[model samples]
Structure formats: structure tokens, C-alpha cells
Target: MLFRQLEYLVALARERHFARAAQACRVSQPALSEALRKLEDELGVLLVRRGRAYEGLTPEGERIVRWAQRILADRDALRDEVDALRTGLSGRLRIGSVPTASGAVPLLTGPFCTAHPLAAVELSTDLRADELLRQVRDFEINAGLSYLPEQGTEGVRTVPLYEERYVLLTGPADGLAGQPHATWTEASRLPLCLLHPGMQGRRVLDGVFAGLGLAPAPRVETDSVGSLFAHVRTGHWASVVPYAWLHVFGVPPGMRAVPLVEPVHSTPIGLVTAAREPGSVMARALREVARRTDLAGVLGALPKA
Candidate 1:
């Protein structure tokens, strides 16, 4: 019934281990266990499956966890709203983003900080879509920048930021560097260094190639954009990256960014936040920044879709 108990339950659901969950909540394992027991007794339903190791949650436990997420999100929003009204808009704004959109964070953070100078902003990057949603649901992050999933989750809000197009990054000496644009099939023939399949950006690229009936097999793959660019700078391996990232990476010396044409491909990226009543001050400020910023201009400057 207590907020702390719900916090413990949600932590346990996330960590999936009693000890680790307790550690995350800064409490003893036994104390957390006891709190869970009391919560189950109050609710008259089992909320967790117990075993020597951490077993998965029961059906009822899964349902309760959803409610727990909603309840905690609402509670945090209330506190934030009250604090913001008492003082100025002062609180932490946690944001998560994919590596490709990392450059766009400054667009939001810079303005929000300028507006609310005392507010603290924490930014974490390169999170998967599901992980980013989980953090928002758990109130770990106030908002996130990610590619909107095909199917949306309940109790979440999304604001489309921009459509990202892929561009070919190659050194000046590379064979294809002279071309203004390259087709997907043509790009596939090059010795390319690309992001691993786990990243959303890579998945988007894979879809584009699959649509063209060409399966792209990169000569080298990496998770970090920096590494991909580093190898491309050597004029050895070419890379496919988001167009917006071209300027951010500054097109390493002797490199050229060519737009991929023929069957142009792009993915929509957006800002996602929990749909809780009485929105937080930080969340409102961020939404304002998103509204005022020129996301379309930013995307327009990138390669044509």
C-alpha cells in the first residue's frame, strides 16, 4: 500500500532478482521481501513467483506490475508539479536516446536549460526501443528520443521529431565518393562498415535493402558511430549512417557524404513520454522545446528521403 513498497515491487520486476532489486532500492533483501509479502497480503493476490533463483512473475504479478507502473508515474508527476509551482521549474529531466539521434539531444537540452537554468538535465544514449520505454514507464527517464515502434504502447505519448535518411560515408579516395547519390543495390556492392543489427538504425537499413531484394552484408560492423567513422576515415571501409549525423561527425577529412537514392529510405524518430495525469514540469518544458525547435529544418538539411 505504501509508495516505497510499490517502488520495491517495480524494482524487483525490473532486476528480476530479489538481492539486486533490493540493492537498487537501497534496502536489505529481507526488508524488500517482507514488503512484497505485505503488499501481496493487502492485495490478496500473489505478485511474484518464488524459487531458489529468480523465476518470472506470475500472470497476476504481471498485471499488478502494470498498475504499479501507472501508480508510481502518477505519484512522481504530482510531486514534480507541486515542486515546480512552489519554486520555478526546478527538477531533473532524464532523457534517453538512440546513438543516431545523440546529436539531437543538444537541441532539446540547450533550450530547456536556458529556460530553466536551475533544472538539472541527465542524458543517456544508445538505448534500445523497449529499454527506453521501460525507463519512461518506471519514471527512470522523463522522456526519450527513439524511433517510434510500429505498434504503440498504451499510456504513452509520442511526438514525431523527424524522419531520418541514410547516407553513404566514404573517404575522398573511395571509388563511389564522386557520386552525388547511390542506389541501395549499388551501395550494397561496396565494402561497407555498418552498425550492428541490434541497433534500430541498422534494422531500418536492413529493411531498405530487403525491400530492394538485396541482402546487405557489411565488410565490418560496430556499435559505435565513432568507430565506424574512424575506419571510414582510413579510406578503407565505407559506412551507411543517418544523414543528420554527417554534420555532427564533421565528415572526417577526405570524406564525402552521398545521399542514397533510387529507392530512398527513411525512418521516423520521435520523443516518447509516459501518459500520466498531471504532467511533470520537466516534461512540459521539454515538450515546449520540441514544439519550438525546427526538427523539420534539421531533417530537411539531411539527404533527401
Candidate 2:
């Protein structure tokens, strides 16, 4: 019945442990349980499945939790609105980002901070594109920085930020190093190190290769951007990565970043937020900042690898 009860229930659903949920809510385990039980009684439904340990929520609880997430999000937005009117916008702006776009996050965050000096930022950069969009839609994050999904933007709104062109990163001694540009076919033949196939960047690259009827067999497969760079740094392997990354992590010494030609591919990265009516104020502010951000001038102006 009360916002605090909904807060406790939402926290419990997120933590899935009575003790941890209580810890997050800054309350005792008994207090949180009693509050949720009262919430269930008031709503005339059983919400949680009880056990000696915390069990999963009931089906109704799942539905109620979704409602709770929305209610809490709206309540927070109201508070932010009032605060903005009274003084200025202030709160933690949560942002989720795909790893490939991690380098560009600071470019957006820095200006957002400057625009709203009282506001704070929290970033989780490990989410993949699909997961990032899911979280943004679920109210789990205020905004997302990622490659725009080809589908599933029905409930999302995005502001285009920048475009990333693919480049071949290789040592001086590689066969393609001296060329003005390399093709997907040429890059596929090298002793290559690549991101894990599940990553968005990898999947994009895979799709391009698949279209060309060439399947690259990598010498090393990793989930880490740093690891891929490290492997290529050893001079034994080559990699194809987004041109945007060169701004943050320069062409690792002894490497040349030749443009990938023969049907040059580019991925559009953007600011993704939920398409729901009356969205988060922080998210809107971020979009405004992204609109003004010369991210293109920052990364796009770089010598095309």
C-alpha cells in the first residue's frame, strides 16, 4: 500500500535474498518481510514463495514486481522534476554500455556532468547490445550507449551518437600492412585474434564475413577487448576492430590500422532510452547533451585508421 513496501518488494526481487534485500533497503530482514507480507494482504494476493531461504517470487509477484519497477521509476522521476524546478536536476544517472562503445562513454558523461553539475553518474559498460536495450526498457538503467539493434526498438527511443567503421589492426610485418586498405577477405586470412562470437562487435563482423562467404578462423578468441589488443600487440595476430576505439586505445605500438575496404561497413552507435511516455529527466538531459556533443568531431575526425 505504501511506497516503502513497494521499494522493499522491488529490492527483494532484485537481490533475491531476504538478508541482502534488507541490507540494500537499510532495514532488518524481519521488517522487510513484514512490509511485503502487508503489501500482499492489502492487495489480496500471495506475492512471494516462502522457504527457510529466499525462494523465487510467485507468478503474481513477478507481475507485481514489474508494476513496482514502473511505479518506482515514475516516483523517482517526479522527485527529480520537483528538484529540478526548485533548484536544478540532481540524481544518479545510470547508464549501461556495450563494451565496444566503452571508450566513448566518457565523452558523453563528461558533458552531462558539466551541464548538470549537481547530478551524478553510474556506468556499467559490460552489457551487450541486446541486454543493454532490455535493461533500458525495464527501467534498470537510465540510458544506454551501444550499436543500434536492427530490430527490437519498438519500445525504445534513440539519439544517434556516432558511427563506427571497421579497421584491420595488424603489425608491420603482416601481408596486408602495406596496403592502402584491406578487405574482409584479406583480413580473414591472417592469424587473427577476435572478440567472442557472442559479443555484438563480433557478431557484426561475423555477419559481414558470412555475407562475403568467408568464415574467419581466429587463432585466439576472447571476451576481452584488452586481451584482443594484447594478442595483436605480440605481433603474432591481427584484429579487426571499430575505428572509434582507436581514439581511446591508439593503434597499439608496432601496429597499423588500415581501413577495411571492399564494402566498407559501419555500425551506428546511439543513446538508447525507453520509449515510454514521460521518460526519465536525467535520460532526457543526457539526450540533449548527446545532441550537442561533438563526438563525431572527436572520434570521427580521426585519420580513418
Candidate 3:
């Protein structure tokens, strides 16, 4: 019945371990367990199916946990609202982003912090789309920067920030370097270095090649964009990456970025927040910053999709 009890229940649901949840809540395991037991007794419903180890939540428990998350989020928002009225907009804003969209975080965070000087911002990068959505739903992040999958998200609100265009990067000495555009079919014939398939960027690139009925057999695969650039610097390999990444991984000397056309591909990248009504002040502030920034303009300027 108590907010503290609901909090404990939610933490347990998220961590799936009583001891870890207790540690997260800064309470002893016994106290946490007692609180949950009291909550279940008061509600007259078994909120958790406990065993020697942390099993999964029951259907009723899952429902309760969802309610708990909303309650806790609203409570936190109320506190933030009251605090902002007294002290101006101020609280930590957490953001999750994929590697390709990492550059855009600063564009949003820099101006947001300037507008709300008391606010703090934390940015974590390289999360996949599903992970990003899960974090937003769990209130682990205030906003996320990720590709808007064509299928669309269920319980999230999104605003298209930019359309990311893929470009071919290679040393100037490479035969295809000076070319203003390269086709997927042409790029496929080269010794390429690429991001690992697990990344959303790689998946998009795979689709582009697949559309051409060509499967690019990369000479090397790496998880880091910096590594991809480094490999291309060796003058032996080429990489296909989003244009936004050019600034983050700084095109190595002697490298040229050629637009990929003749079936050019682009993916819409956007900012996402939970679909819940009455979002937190931090989330609202981020949305405001996103609105003011040149995200759409920057992306729109890229060569044809």
C-alpha cells in the first residue's frame, strides 16, 4: 500500500533478484521482503511467486508491476514539478542512443543544459532499438535516439529527427574515392570493412545490399565506428556508414566520403519517449531541445535517399 512497498516491488520486477533490488533501494533484503509481504497481504493478492531463487513474475504480479511503474513515474514527476517551481527546471536527464546517432545527442544536450542550467545530462551510446525502447518504458532513460523502424513502435511517441544517408568511405588513393557516388553493386565488389551485423546501422546497410541482390562480403567486421575508420586508413578496405558518423569518427586523412546512390538508401532516425501522458520535466525539456535543433534540416540536406 505504501509508495515504498510499490517501489520495492517495481525494483524487484526490474532486477529479477530480491537482493539486488534491495541493494538498489538501499535497504536490507529482510526489510525489502517484509515490505513486499505486507503489500501482498494488504492487497490480498500474491504479487510475486517466490522460490529459493528469483523466478519470473506471475501474470498478476506483472500487472501490479506495470501499475507500480506508472505510480512511481508520476510520483517522481510530481516531485520534479514542485522542485522546478521553487528552483527552476533541474534534474538528471538520461539519454540512450545508437552509435550512429551519438553525434546528435550533443546537439540536443548542449542546448538543453544551457536553457535549463541546473539540469544534468547523461548519455549512453550503442544501444539497439529494442533495448532503447525497453529503457524508455522502464524509465531508465528520459529519451532515446534511434532509427524509427518501418513497423513502428507500440507504446512510444517519436519525432523524426533526421534521415541518415549511407556513404562510402575510403582513402583518396582508392580507385573509387574521387567518385561523387557509388552504387551498392560497385561497393560490394570492393574489400570492405563494416560494422558488425548486430548494429542497426549494419542491418540497414544489409537491406540496401539485399535490395540490389548483392551480399557484401566484408573483409573485416568491427563493432566500433572508430575501428572501421582506422581499418579504412590502412588503405586496404572501404566502409559504408551514415554521414553523421563522419564528424564523430573524423574522416581519416586521405579519406573521401562518396554518397551511395543508384539506389541510395537512407533510414529515418528519431527521438523517442514513453507514450505515457504527463511526461517528466526532464523528458519535456529534451523534447523542446529536439524541436529547436537543426536535426531535420541536417538530415534533409543529405543526398537523395
Candidate 4:
């Protein structure tokens, strides 16, 4: 019944172990167990599955965990709101982004930090579109920067940031360097270094190739953009990357970037946050940052894709 109990329960659900959960909550093991039991007694339903180890949450516990997440989120939102009124917005803002959008993140974060110097902004690029949404929904991240989902999703509001276009980055020594544009089919035939299949960007590229009836077998696959840059910078490898990336990370010394054409496709990328009304002050600030950002100016300066 207590907010502390909800906190403990949520922590337990996340950690999935009594001792670790207690450690996360900065409490002793017995205290965490007692709090959960008291919570169950107050609610008259078991909130955890008991065993020598953390078996899992009970069915009712599963549902309660969700509610606990919402309640804690709302509680934090309330606290942030009150503090913002008194201190002009001070709190940590967490944002998760897909790796391909790594370059574009600074566009939002820069202004956000400038506008609210007192606030702390943490940006992570190690998540996929679905994972980004999941973390946002779970309140693990305050917001997400990712490709817009095909179908509208529930419990989240999206603000379209910009359209992502494809391009091929290779060194001047590469054969295709002088080409005005390359098709997905042609790009697939090169000794290409590409993002892992798990990445949403890779999936989009794969879809383009599949539609052309071309299956690309990459020479090297990596999850790190830096790795792709490292290989391609040698002028021996070519890679397909977002056009914005060219602007973000300029065509490195010897590299040249060519737009991907002949069935060129563009996907919408955006900012996503929980749909909760009266959203956290930081969340609202990020929304404003998204709105005020000149995405066209940023992406437009880049070579067209």
C-alpha cells in the first residue's frame, strides 16, 4: 500500500532476485521480503512467487508490477513537476536511440541541454526500435529516438523528427567512389561492411535488397558504427549508412558518400515518450526540443540521398 512497497516490488520484479532487489533498493534482504508481504497483506493477494531462488512473480504479481511501474512513474513525474516549479526544471532525462540515429542525437540533446542547463541528459544508442519503445513504456528511459513504427503503438506519443535516407560510404580509392548514386542491388554486391541483422537499420536495408531480389552477404558485420567507419576508412570496404550520418560524421578523410537510388526509400524517425498526460517536465522539454529543431536544415545540408 505504501509507495516504498511499490518501489520494492518493482525493484524485485526487475532484479528477479530477493537479495539483488534488496541491494538495488538499498535495503536488507529481510526488509524487502517483509515489505512485499505487507504489500500483499494490504492488497490481499500474493505479489511474488516464493522459492529458494526467485522463481518469478505470481500472475497477480505480474499485473501489480505493471501498475507499480505506472505508479512509480507518476510519483516521479509529480516530484519532478513540483521541483521544476521551484527550481526551474532539474532532473535526469534518459533517452534511448537506435544506433543508426546516433549522429542525429546531438541535434536534440544540444538544444535540450542549452535550454535547461540544470538538467542532466543521458543518451544511449545501444537499443533497437522495439527495445527503445519497451524501455520508454517501462519508464526505464524518459524518451526514445527511433524509426516510427509501422502501426501506431499504444501508451506512447511520437513526434516525427526527420526522414532517414540511405547512402553508400566508401573511400576515394574504391571503385564506386565517383558514382553519382548506387542502387541497393549494386551496393549489396560490394565488399560491404554493414550493421548486424538485429539492427532496425539493417532490417530496412535487407528489405530493400530483398525487394530487388538481391540477397546481400556482407563482408563484415558489426553493431558499432565506429567499426564500420574504421573498416571503410581504410578505403578497402564500403558500407551503407544513413545520409544524416554523412553530415554527422563527415565523409572521413578518404571516404566519399553516394546516395542510394533506384528504388530509394526513406523512413521516418521520431521522438517517442510515454502518452501519460501531464508528462514529466523533462519529457515535455524534450518534446519542445524536437519541435524547435530544424531537422530539414540539418539533413538538408547533407548530400541528398
Best-fitting candidate, scored by lDDT: 2
Give me the runs in candidate 2 sitting further than 4 Å from their true place: none
Q: In model 2, what is the error at residue 195, expressed in angstroms?
A: 1.2
Candidate 2 per-residue C-alpha lDDT over 1-305 given as tens digits, one digit per residue, 9 for 90 to 100? 48999999989988999999999999999999999999999999999999898889999999999899899889888898889888899989999999889889999999889989999999998898888987887798999999987787888999988888888989989978888889999899898999999999899999999999999999899877778778888899999888778888887668888999887888899999988778789988999999999887788754533
Residue 65 displacement in candidate 3 (angstroms): 0.8
Worst 10 residues of 4 by lDDT: 296-305
The deviation in Å at residue 13 for candidate 2 is 2.4
Encode model 3's per-residue lDDT on 120-231: one tens digit a residue.
8888887887889888887878899999856657778888888888889888887778777888888899899998898888888898889888997898998887788888
Note the residue pairs that clash in candidate 2: none
Error of 1 at 227 (Å): 2.1
lDDT of 1 by residue, 1-305 (tens): 48998999889988999999999999999999999999999999998889897797889999988788778877877877777788877778999998888877887898889988878999998888788887887677899999987785776788888888888888777667788787888889888899888888888888888888999789898888888889888878888888777657666667888889878888888898878766666787798899888876865685321
Q: For candidate 4, write residues 1-305 as lDDT tens digits.
A: 49999999989988889999999999999999999999999999988989888899999999999999998899999998998889878899999999988788988889998998889988888898888998899898899989999875898999998999988888887677788887777788899999999989899989989988999889899998778889998877899988788776677787888888988799999999999988777899999999999885788556532
RMSD of each: 2.4, 1.9, 2.6, 1.9
lDDT of each: 0.83, 0.89, 0.84, 0.88
Which regions in candidate 1 have their CA more than 4 angstroms from the true location? 302-305
The local lDDT score (0 to 100) that residue 195 gets in candidate 1 is 89
TM-score (C-alpha) between model 1 and the true structure: 0.92
Query: In candidate 1, how many Å is residue 268 off?
Result: 1.7
The prediction achieving the highest TM-score against the true structure is 4
